[model samples]
Target: MIRHILLIKFLATADTAQIKHLQTLFEAMPQKVTGVLTVEWGVNNSPEYRNKGYTHSVLMTFADEAGRQNYLPHPEHLALKQVLRPLLDDIIVFDFQL
Candidate 1:
């Protein structure tokens, strides 16, 4: 299995509604793409305040490396990126085997 993580920093102009819309889009991925086992989203709520401006996170679990690779170029993912790009100041993607 693979654990895929995304740390997101949205632009100041991005509103709550837009953020929620993005979350909705992300939540739909498992149903739209094969081998996507699960998708989880969350907002930063740490008391330590060490998020470095990243306010949201998306965590995806894939069945295998092929699943992760497949997700990279999937049409649904491309569409999601189109919706996400304009709202972001920056993003960090990290993955690890599990």
Candidate 2:
């Protein structure tokens, strides 16, 4: 299995509704893409406050490396990026085999 994680920081102008919409889109990925095992979304909630302004995260599980690669250029992912790009102040992606 592969673990794919995204850390996101929203632009100051990004609104709650837009953020929620993006979350909705992300949560729908397992249903839309092949080889996607699961998708999870979350907000920063630590009292430690070490987040460096990153406010949200997406954790995804893929069946394998090929699945992860396939997800990168999938049309649904591209569409998600279209919605996500404008709202972002910064983004970080991390992936590893599990």
Candidate 3:
């Protein structure tokens, strides 16, 4: 199995509505594309100081490395990244085969 995890940090002025929309779009990707075992997304609502800067995370599970590769360039995935790129300060992607 393969896991694709994305951690994103946004500038405070970033469009919250658009962020939510992108989260929803990404969460639905497993249903739209092949080889996805599971997908999840969440916003940082914790009032804790730990993630004082970073705001959101997306965790995706794939059947294998090939599944993750397939997911990467999928049209919908690209579209979501386009929607998010402008608002984000930084994005970190981690993939591991388990």
Which regions of candidate 1 fall more than 4 Å away from where they truly are? none
lDDT (tens digit, per residue) of candidate 1 on 29-90: 99999989999999999999999999999999999988988999999999999999999999
Candidate 2 versus the native: TM-score? 0.97
| Regions of model 2 farther than 4 Å from truth | none
lDDT ranking from best candidate downward:
2, 1, 3
How does each model score on lDDT? 0.95, 0.96, 0.84
> What TM-score goes with each of the models?
0.97, 0.97, 0.86
How good is model 1 by TM-score?
Answer: 0.97
Superior by TM-score: candidate 2 or candidate 3: 2
* lDDT, candidate 2, at 9: 96
Q: After superposition, how far is residue 9 of candidate 1 from its true place, in Å?
A: 0.5
**lDDT measured at residue 35 in model 1 versus the true structure, 0 to 100:** 82
- Once model 2 is optimally superposed onto the true structure by TM-score, how far is the C-alpha of residue 12 displaced, in angstroms? 0.7
What are the per-residue Cα lDDT tens digits for candidate 2 across 42-98? 999999999999999999999998888889999999999999999999999999998
Q: All candidates: CA RMSD in angstroms?
A: 0.6, 0.6, 1.8
